[model samples]
Structure formats: structure tokens, C-alpha cells
Target: MIKTQQLVKNFVSYKKKPGIMGSIESLWKREAVTKNAVERFDLEIPSGQIVGLLGPNGAGKTTLMKMFTGIIVPSSGEVEVLGHKPFDRDKDFRRKIALVMGQKSQLWWDIPAMDSLHLIKAYYEISDADFKERVELMAELLNVEELLHIHVRRLSLGERMKLELMASLLHKPEILFLDEPTIGLDLIAQDAIRDFIKSYHAKYKPTVILTSHYMQDVQALCSRLVLIMGGKKSFDGPIGEFERLLGSDKIVSFNFSSEPSRDFFNAFQPKWSDNGLQVEIAISKEELCPFCAKVLEQFEVSDFQTEKLPIERIMKELMMRPELLNDR
Candidate 1:
């Protein structure tokens, strides 16, 4: 379980002016700029839930994660994780939580992955039997058993990430903080990581807080989504509700054998593909069937399909125009 009330993290830095003259004048007179990376953030997460924290760059998602995991202390407000203040750094609190950052590496580069894992086993004081069992099971699940003895620097990013995850979960932490776990991975590798996380959560039931740029990762693993914008919590709800934020209309795309005139589809707000052979349009549920039939009859259609509002589109819209949430 986790809870935060008016959680705020502020960062202070000196503002440096551009150019040589400006730089030379700043030795004693530089202005101090204070930024609230996370401001008045309030959140509560129950145990055994996979919650996705989403936002664009500089949206304070990482700041909140750092505060939650005790990597950094907040400027003001209260935050409690598993009944302990994270900033207290209690040994039991540390033991019960694990934070995995994709852009950061926990394993040594020159040593084999298993070698690093052994060090983690000692650090966590895990029993030999438990360590061996966890390593074997996680490696098998991630299909990385053969890479266990390979030097970390030699393995690909995907392989290294799998080993990193195994190392973090060795002690079975009660809460898992995953920051972009599938970042920079190919589609296959991304899917593999997502599937492994789902399988792990199902079997172990750990409380997971995931932050990812890839909506696919959120869609696959999280039932709840928390949207952060401009250092504030903008929305918190189920994935279905997040998707339906823009509207209940269906997003349908059609491929045409020949380019169709935009005028005919103008009323539907069509978004055409680069080659102009495909167009995606939003149609209200009530008009979906009739509109499709009309388009089929009017155009030389090659293929078409429909889908619910996409998370990526919603995120883009929100980032570009935060006012979309005014009605909420």
C-alpha cells in the first residue's frame, strides 16, 4: 500500500545567462530559480495493483517515482509506502521495495550477469536455496538461462534488462517500481518483457508502479492509469476510462485502391496516411454502420477496420491542449 498527501518536490538551481559576458557576470549575482518538479501530488495505491504513471517529458513522472522509491527526498508534504516514510530509509522499507530504471544499470559491466546476481544475493541476504530457485525460475521464464554467465557488457540491451529484472526480484520485494523497463527494445523484445512482467505479477502479486513512454506496455500490463501533467496529477482512473476521454466514437481506418477525394470524407475529420492510400476517421457509434456502408459503396475500398480511441492519440491531444480535461 502507498499514500501521499500534498506531495511536493522542488529543485533549486542557478540561472546562467548565455554568452561570455553573461557567464562572467554570474559569479556572485546569479539568480536562483526554483522549480516544483512535483507539486501538490496526492495519490493512493492499493497492494497487488499494476498502475501506470504516464506523461510527456518534464511532466514530473520521474520526480514522483524518485520520491516514492526514496531515491530523492521531497521538499514538502507527506508520503508513506507500506506504512513507512520512504525518506527514513529504514532497512525493512528498503527490503520491501525494488526500483528498476531502464536507463540505469545495476549490474557490473565487466562481470558475468550471474556474478552480479550473486553479489545481489549477498546484499539482500537471501538464503542460498531461495537465491538459486529465484534465479533459475526467472531466467527460465525470461528465456535467458544461457546468458546468465555471459558478461553484462557483451549481452544485448534486451538480455541485460532481463537479467537486471531477475536480480531485482531475487528477494521478492513487496513493491516494484519499474521506470521504462521496455524502453529502446524492439517490438519482440518489448512484448517479451511485458509478458514476463504479467506472468510474474500473476504468480507473485506484487504491487507494481510502471512508467513507460510506450502505450503498449501500459495497455498490456496496467488496469489503472494515472496521468501527470505540468507537475500535477491530471487524471487517475481505469484504462478504459482513459481511452474514452476524447469521446466514445470509434476510430476507423480504410485502405483504398486509389486516392479518394478529401471533400467526401471532410465531415468525418479524416486523417490521411502519407501516401494518401489510407485514411483514418472518427465516426460516432450511432453513425458507424451507415457511414461504413456509404464509404464502401462510394469508394474502391481495399481493407478497413475499427478500434476504440487510442491511448497514444489521447496523450498527444492532452499534451498539445491540456484544456481537453477542463470538463473532467
Candidate 2:
């Protein structure tokens, strides 16, 4: 279980002057800018669920994740994880949660990942039998048995990332906060991690909060989403509810061999837009067939394509019109 009530975190940043004289003055009297990374961010995530922590850069996704992991204490309010205050940094609390950041690595770069695992095992005081069983299980789940003995510096980005997951999951934390877990991975590698996360979720049933710019990851794995913007809670609800924001309208596009006359387009009188297609029609989700029939009668259409709003476009639209993200 996890919950945050009026959770707030602010950063004080000093402003430096442009010129050398101004820079010298900045040393004596600093002008600090305060940024509210999270302002009264309220969250309640139950166990055994994956919640997408979605927002653009500087939207407080990473800031919230850090606070949950006990690495950074919130400036105000309460955060309780599994019945313990996270910022207390209790050893018992640390043992029950794991945090993985995309740009940061907990593994030793110069040595084999197994070496790092062993070191963590000693640090956590894991029993020999428990450590061996957990390592073997995690290695198989992550599919990094062969790469375990290889140096992390020599491994590919995907390989190192898989190893990082293995390291994080070794202690079997009850709560996991993954920030951009698949940031740099290609489709193949991303799918692998997605599959692993799914299977791991099914088996372990931990409370998971995953933050990423990649909408595909959220669409693939998270049924529920928690949207943040400008350091505030924008929305928190099912992903399906978010999809319905565009009203399920269908987009039908046609390619023409030549630009038809303005009169020809006027006859059809479709919702005029810049599709480079001489003509573009907006059809209700249920009226695709009739709309296509109406279009084909006039223009010499070479190709036609119909598509629903992509996740990326829906996200962009929501970002532009933040009211669309209002919580249910």
C-alpha cells in the first residue's frame, strides 16, 4: 500500500548573473529561484497494481519517485509506504522497496554484474541459500544468465539495463518505483522488459509506480494512469477513460495524384485541414464506410487510410488542453 496527502517538494536554485562582474556579485548575495516540483500531490496506490506516472519533463514525475524511494524527503506533508514513513530511511523500509532510475545505475561498471549482485547480497545480509535462489530466479526472469559474468562496461545498453533490473529485484521489494525503465531500448528490448514487468507483477504483486515519456509502455502495461502537470495532479484514473478524450472519432485520409480544383474540394466540403491530400474527411467512429463512399464518388483517389488517434497524438492533445485531463 502507498499513499501521499498534500505531499510537496520544492527546490531552491540560485540564479547566476551573465557578466563577470555580475557573476562576482552572485558569489556574495545569491538570488535563488524556488521551484515547486510537487505541490500537494495526493496519490493512493494499492498493492499489486502498476500505475503510470506520466507527464512531460519537469512535471515532477522524477521528483515524486525520488520522494517515494526515501532518497529525497518531501518539503511538506506525509508519505507512507507499506505502513512506514519513507523518509525515515529505516533499514526495514529500505529492504521492502526498490527504486530504479533510467540515467542512473546501481551496478558497478568496471566489474561483472554478478560481482555487484554479490556485493549487494552482503550489504543486505541475504543468506547464502536465499541469495542463490533469488539470483537464479531473477537471472532467469531477466534472461541475463550469460551476461551476468561479463563486465557491465562491455555489455550493450539493453544488457546493462536488464542487469540493473535484476539488481533491483534481488531483494524482493514490496514496492517498486521505476523511472523511465525503457528510455533507450528499441522495440525488441522494450518488449522484453515489458513482458518481464508483466510477469513479475503477476507473481510478486508489488505496488509499482512507473514514470516514462514513452506512452507505449503505459499503454502496454498500465491499466490506470496518474497524470501530472506543472507540479500538480492533473488526473488519476483508468487509461481507457483517457482514450475516450478524443471521442473515438475516425480520421480518413486519401492521397490524390494531383491537386484537385478548389471547387472540386468544396463539393465534398470535408473538415478542411492540412493533410497534403487535396481532401481530408473527418468521420464519426461509426460512419467510416459512408464517409468513404461519399469521398470516392468525386476525387481520383490513389490511396486511402483510416486510423484512430494514436496514443502520442492523444497525449499531445491532452497536454495542449489540460482540461481534458481533469480527474473523474
Candidate 3:
């Protein structure tokens, strides 16, 4: 469980002049400007939910995660995680949460991953038997049992990320904060991580907050999405409802034995592929059934498929039109 009421974080930076004289003048007359990294952000996350935090650069997603994990204190407002104020950094609260950043590593570069894991075991005060069991389970789930003994620096990026996740989850924290856990990983590696997250959540039911630029990661793991812009909450709802904001448009594709006559699809404005055997068209939700009937009657279709608009396009539309937030 987590809650935030008008959570805000402001960063202050001073402006400096170029020349030495101007710099000396700046020493006494320095200009300090405050930038709001998070502004009046309110959020509520229930236990056993995988929520995706999405936004563009400078959107304050990372800042919010830091506040949740007790890594940074909020400038104003309130934040509570598992019934404890995160800013207090209580020992028990720290034990209930973990933060993993893809760009950063907790494993010792020159030592084996198991070595770092052993340190974690002692830090968390986990029993030796429990620690061994947790490590075995994590290794089995991630399929990285062999890499545990290899030094972190020698492991590939994907291998390092897997070990990072194992290290984070070994203590079975009640809340997990993941910021770009799959960044820079290939398709196979990404899928493996996604599957592991899904399985772990289903089994343990820990509340998970994930921020990722890759749409696939969000699609695969998150049921609800919180979209933020300019350090403010833009939209918060299920992924399906977010897509519906764009419209009721659906893409329909048809494959035929051969190319149809130009006049056959002129009225529909279908986009044909280079091979000329396939055509694609966009139709509204209301017209889908009727259009399919017409196409079935007019052409000898070998195969047909329909798909909703991609999340990427829907996100782009939301970014362009911030007013949609009021519609929520």
C-alpha cells in the first residue's frame, strides 16, 4: 500500500556567468532558480498491483520513485508506504522496500555475484537456510544459476541485469520500485525479465511500481498506468481505457489469393503492400462488422485480422493533448 498527497520536490540551482569578473560578480549576486521536479502529485497504489509510471524525459518519474523508496525526501506534502512515512527511512520500512535502477548496479564489479548476494544476506539478516533457498529459487526463475559465481564485470549486460533483479528480490520486499529494469537489453533478455517479473508478482503479490520507456515492458507487466507530464499527474487508469481515449478506430487487414481490381477497393482507400496480395484499412468500431461483411462478399479473402491502435501512438496523442487529463 502507498499514498501521496500533493507530493512536491523542488531543486535549486544557481546561475553562473562566463568571465572571471562576471563570475566574481555572481559570487555576491548569485541567481537561484527553483525547478519543480514533482508538482502536487497525488497517487494511491494498492498491494499486489503492478503499476506502470510513464512519461517523457524530465517528467519526474525517477524523482517520484526516489521519494517512494526513501532515497530522497519530498520538499512538501505527504508520502506513506506500508503505513510508515518513507521520508523517515525507518529500518523496518527500508526492509519492506527495494529500488532497482537499470543504469546502476549493486553487485561488486570485481567480485562474484554470489559474493555480493552473501553481503546482502547479512545486511538483511536473513537466515542462512532461507537465503540459500531464496537464491536457488531466483536463479531457477531467471535461468542464471551458472552466472552467480562469475564476477559481475565479466558478465554481459543481460546477465548483469538478471543478477541485479535476483539481488533486489532475495529479501522478498513488500514493495518493489523498478526504474528501467530492462533498459538496453535485447528482445530475448527483455522477454525473460518480463516473464520473471510477472511470475514473481503472481507468486508473491508484492506491490510493484515500474517505469520504462519501452512500451512492450509496460504492456507485458502492468495492468494500470499512471501517465505524468511536466512533473504532474496527467492520466491514471487501466491501459485499455487509456487507449480508448484516442478513438474507436481498429485496423483490419485482408489477404487474398491475388490482387483485387483497383476499382474494387477504391471507395475504401485500402493501403496495399508491395506484393499486392494484402491490404490494410482503418475502420471505426461501429463499422467493423458491416465492413467485414462487405469485404467477405466482394473478395475471396484468405485470411483476415483486426487489431487495436498501438499504445505508442495512443501515448503520443496523450502527450500532444494534455487536456485529456481533465477528461479523466
Best by lDDT: 1
- The alpha-carbon deviation from the true structure for residue 56 of candidate 1, after best TM-score superposition, in angstroms, is 0.8
RMSD (Å) per prediction: 1.9, 3.4, 3.1
> How does model 3 fare in lDDT?
0.89
Ranking by TM-score: 1, 3, 2
Tell me the tens digit of each residue's lDDT in model 2 across 65-100.
988888899999999989989889999999988888
> Which should have the higher lDDT, number 2 or number 3?
3
Report the Cα lDDT for residue 106, model 2.
Answer: 79
Predicted candidate 3 versus true structure: per-residue lDDT over 200-310, tens digit per residue = 999999999999999899999899999889999888999887767666577788998867765666665588999988988767888889878987888888999986336
lDDT of 2: 0.83
Estimated TM-score for each candidate: 0.94, 0.86, 0.88
Which candidate leads the pack in TM-score?
A: 1
Off by over 4 Å in 2: 251-282, 288-309, 321-328
lDDT of 1 by residue, 210-250 (tens): 99999999999999999999899999999999988989778
Q: How close to the true structure is residue 36 of candidate 2, measured as C-alpha lDDT? A: 96
